[model samples]
Target: MEIEIATIGGYEEVGRQMTAVRAGDDIVVFDMGLNLSKVLIHDDVRTEQMHSLDLIDMGAIPDDRVMSDLQGDVKAIVPTHGHLDHIGAISKLAHRYDAPIVAAPFTIELVKDEIQDENKFNTENDLVTMEAGETMPIGDSGELDLEFVNVTHSIIDAINPVLHTPEGAVVYGLDKRMDHTPVIGDPIDMDRFREIGREGEGVLCYIEDCTNANKKGRTPSESVARDRLKDVMYSLEDYDGGIVATTFSSHIARVKSLVEFARDIGRKPILLGRSMEKYSGAASRMDGVDFPDVEMYGRRQGIERTFQRIMNEGKGNFLPVVTGHQGEPRAMLTRMGRAETPYELDEGDKVIFSATVIPEPTNEGQRYQSENLLGMQGARIYDDVHVSGHLSREGHYQMLQALQPQNVIPAHQNMKGFSGYVELAGNQGYKLGRDLHVTTNGNVIQLVEE
Candidate 1:
């Protein structure tokens, strides 16, 4: 039996995520996605509307080599969660292979919306939705098995994909935060993670998310973000105008908290933009999570109408949750700044950003321009009132202590980022280029009997 793992994208770079695991003739791929920050900045398009699949032809699609390996033997293409960085490229590239695209329920909803919006992708291959904590067969080949283990991130139902191979089990812990106190979903299923680790004979190799591999300490919980937002909201009860809060739509946990906070202030929540509708709708339809019923409107005309109603009724009567927390020029906030909509921001109005700047230069510039414009208009702006989804260096050490896998591979990060993990792994007795491997995209590492 032979097993090989390759990173198609998101190795030395940040997005366009694809990883392939090939065992014999069968192969399973994870996360066919696009480099969103690059695509958005280079094309000068709004992040959300960057959906036109035509961009793939323009060489915007990240490396598809991972998928090409199983050109015919591809049994499954799974994205661990709904974040665009994981699933965004599937609709654009899945047709190249015949495998089914498997995902969690809410993630499937987001993908369906993408397909519907584009009116593209006509294929009969199965689009499977699996529940968290369930084990599933990858193919009839009998050499490969894949399972989804529930994990916490900014989004609800995020998962860590575990691959069971003849050599041993390899866990792909991508885009996770070891938050034991996630606000919307069950805590990291430590029991299941351990069980899988044990069943796989102590896990031959572990590929983990090193996105925040350099930061210190465990990531704060969603509850922390909620408390921060609550504090910001409580300070503004004396003034009554418009209250607008924007965050990652995939952040169902944060969204839930924001909705509850608005309810506490006696304000009905109003969602605007295509993403707000898509994510909230997906979460509501999922079995376990439920978003409070609210008015979801879109398009400048629709938002303008809702704003007029809210204004005439009473600014204190509603909370407007729109997109553009990243300050994307075409998002609702920028449109509001440009006065393209009928709604106006009064001096006492509040705009709260429950998200951190993602650190991309373009995002920073757009955010700067948008915030300056909003400040000039006298709208109170609150920024970065939230926690991150990725685990930091300290958190990574903790995870290593917990799993204690025999082999460690630092993934999803650049050279310097991988160096940090190498240092941590080294102190723990794992050697560089040996027991601990820092790999590049497309470089395969094989695990063998010790």
Candidate 2:
């Protein structure tokens, strides 16, 4: 049997993550994603109507033409999570592959929604639902098995797909944090990971997301952010003025916290925006998900109507959890800042930004402008009441200790961004150009050959 890996996308940057593992004649592709920053840099780019080739040319999606270089049939298109950077391109590119789009239940539901909204492509790939801690056979090869190891991320239903092969376990270790006390789901399955390290052939190759590898200390648990959020909302309890909050609409746990705390602080929580309705609605409808029943407005008319109601009923009685934590021009928060919506920001009103500024030129500039606009309107801003979804240096060291893979590949960042991980792995006895592979997009690494 032969084992090979392809770094298709997201090797040199944080978004548009796609990778493939070939076990002999059977290949499994993971995460056909989109580079959101690329899309954000342009004006009015409707990705739903764009061609795959053009999006590739614009660096908005993975250039999957390199898939032809891998001499194996694609057995499964497994997405690790539901984030756009992990599953956005599925609607655009999955039509080219014959494999089923396998993922966790929530992720599968999100993929269905993505496919339904797509206009340029008709992706009819079978959406298979596989929960965490479950395994499915891959291709016709009895020696290959695909397993989903539950991992905690900002979003629920996140997993790290592991391809169990005759050579060893090819662990697709992308976007995740060491969260033991997550708010909505089980903690990061470190016990399972430690077991995988000591079992079978032991992890042959570990591909990691180096998004926060440069930061010191482990990433804080979601529970920490939850506590901070609770404290902030409670402190604003006696205030009679309006309070508006915004976060990553896909962050269900954080949204849940906001909703719960809003009621605790004597306010009705209203979810406003298209993505707010999309993600939270999906979570609310899922089985075993105990999300609160709250009001959500996704359409332009409905959102405007809801804004009018919030103002008429007195803004102090409601908390509007909206989109545009990064200050996107048309998002609910930005429109509120611009006074374009029916909801008005009065003097001394609070705006809680429960997300960090995304480290990109477009995001920084937009966020700065949005904050200044809000400030000019006398809106008091509260920022960074959140924790990152990626692991830091200590967390990376812990993963290397647990997986103890024969080979390590740093991913999800640029060469300079991978430095902290490189230094950490070197302490664990992994070397560059040897077992530690620092690769780029559209490259292949042969770990085993017949």
Candidate 3:
């Protein structure tokens, strides 16, 4: 049996993740994502007119040209989660190949919403939904089996897929952490991973996330963040001003915690911004989680009216949950900081950022500007009351020990993060470029029979 793997994108960078695995005559693609930095830089003026090829040229999306020769052999497109970096490009690129798009329900809903927003939904591209813990056969001859192993992450319905091929099992272990005490969904399926490692043909290759490899010890659980948020909110119970909290819109568990705490403190929880509405609606539709008591405003005019009402009712009576945790220039929190909203920031008002700045230059600049604007209005700023969703060094070590694959490939990182992963893997007795593969995008590694 011949099996080859190619890194289409997200090798030396942190976004636009796409990987192609070819087993004999059939090929299965994992994740058609986008590089947000590139998209922000290049697609600012003519975003509407930018085609798939244009995005590829600007590095906004994956350059599938690497798979031109094997396009006809492609069987399926699988996405692991609903993050924009993981599912944003599917609407633009899925039409290129004659295959169905498969993912968990929440992810599929997010993809569908993207297609509708872009007006690019084609009848030819079908969507197939697979719940976590279910296994399905792909390809015309059913030569490959795809299993979705449930895992906990920032988003609900996240999974680590294991592709059972004729040669062996190939595991895609990216964008997830081992969170046993998740706030909303089930914990990581440790038993299933161990079974795959010890049973059957065993894991031949493991492609893992190295985003947080520089950090030592296991990444803290979402429950930890929940506790931190509770402490922050409870401490402000006596403060007589509006409380504004912001985080990633797709972080449903975080949203749930915030909403619950807001309601518990007798404050009305209001969700603002288009993304906040889209992701929360998708989560509710998938039966993942629901915030029936929280009022959400998606349109600009509606959000304006909502803010006006909050102002009239007194800021201390309501909690505003908004976007712009990364300080996107157009997001609601930035607009609020700029005093564009009808509601004014009062002295000693709290603006809590339940997120960390993603260490990118653009994000750093934007976040600084936003914070400056809020600080000028006498709003007290609290930041980084959250935990990351990716695995740290100890988390990676535990995963390696559980899976115990023959070869390890560090993915979803730049050189710094990958180097950290290399050092950690070395401690486990795996050498670089031999049993461990550290490669850049577009590089192919052919696995030989042992």
Model 1 gets an lDDT of 0.76
Model 3 pairs whose backbones collide: none
Q: Identify the runs in model 3 with alpha carbons over 4 angstroms from their true place.
A: 42-49, 69-72, 120-123
The order of the candidates by TM-score, greatest first, is 2, 3, 1
Q: Which 10-residue window of candidate 2 scores lowest in summed lDDT? A: 284-293
Q: Pick the candidate with the highest lDDT.
A: 2
**How would you encode candidate 1's per-residue C-alpha lDDT over 11-81 as one tens digit per residue?**
77666777877777777888877666666565464434543345554434556654555433778888888
Name the candidate, 1 or 3, with the larger TM-score value.
3
RMSD of each: 2.7, 1.0, 1.7
lDDT of 2 by residue, 1-450 (tens): 899999999988888999999999999999999888888767789999888999999998898888899898998999999999999999999999999999999999899999999999889899999999999899887899999999989899999999999888989998899998889889889988899898999999999999898898889999999999999999999999999999999999999999999999999999999999999999888853556678988999999999999889999999999999988877888888898999889899999999998766678898999999999899999999999998989899888889889999999988889998999899999999999999999999999999
Measured with C-alpha atoms, the lDDT of residue 221 in candidate 3 is 95
Pairs with steric clashes in candidate 2: none
Task: Give residue 21's lDDT in candidate 3 (0 to 100).
Answer: 86
lDDT of 3 by residue, 83-177 (tens): 98888788788888888988998998998887876653353578999988999997766678999999988999899888898777999987899
- TM-score (C-alpha, index-matched) for candidate 3: 0.97
